[model samples]
Target: TESSTAQWANEDCDTQKLPFVCRRAGSVSVPAECPHEAQKPGKDIIAPGFPIHGIPCEYMLAVDAKSLVHLEILALEANPNIDFLEIYEGTMGHNLLANLTGTISNPAIYITKSANVMRVN
Candidate 1:
């Protein structure tokens, strides 16, 4: 089921099977490597076409092996219940640092626990 505001609808939790729809803003191709635009500090990772629709994006932020990467969400505008930002320590399967959703009133900061790799999805 689709609504004006993006949301998850469990039409039938018992017998209905629904295909997952993934959305992305713009025509940008998923890069084999991290995009250069996301490699800088203090960069904002706004949803591609924010305030309209949010697409599924995977961001891998990597730094020098000896250095640490810090991620801060300066401002976020999205449905807290449906759209969210998942932060992992190293990769997607690694330790989850935080699951951020909703309008962030206070800035959230996360530091990598191990290695210089942080995955955001």
Candidate 2:
């Protein structure tokens, strides 16, 4: 219901559409508006929304890392033990935290496909 643009196709939404619009983009921290409740994937997940690819939004904000204003630093749920907490791909990286100290968890090893497969002897 947040997508004011979805209701109309190529028509000026200002005349007949609601102000709220849902523009879904990948790895984008800030979306146009919160995704529609019906099309929502799940709760507590920040990036849970219907992805509208190949499209852009009229109203979107960008907060550059270098230009972010420092109002005040706040404490999080974990500290001292927590090295860093980043909001990646619109989702808080809580899943990675749980597996940090387990056998199945290897944060150091990342999965990558290399073109030179025959290099390994």
lDDT of 2 by residue, 11-89 (tens): 4457857665543333434344544432211112222222332121111112343332111112222223432233212
CA deviation > 4 Å runs, candidate 2:
1-61, 64-67, 86-121
TM-score per prediction, in order, is 0.64, 0.14
Kindly report which residue pairs in candidate 2 clash with one another.
none
Give candidate 1 regions above 4 Å deviation.
1-38
lDDT of 1 by residue, 1-121 (tens): 2422343433553565556444433443322333445556555665544444456778888888898879987767768688778888886546888888778878778998776888888
| Candidate 2 global lDDT | 0.26
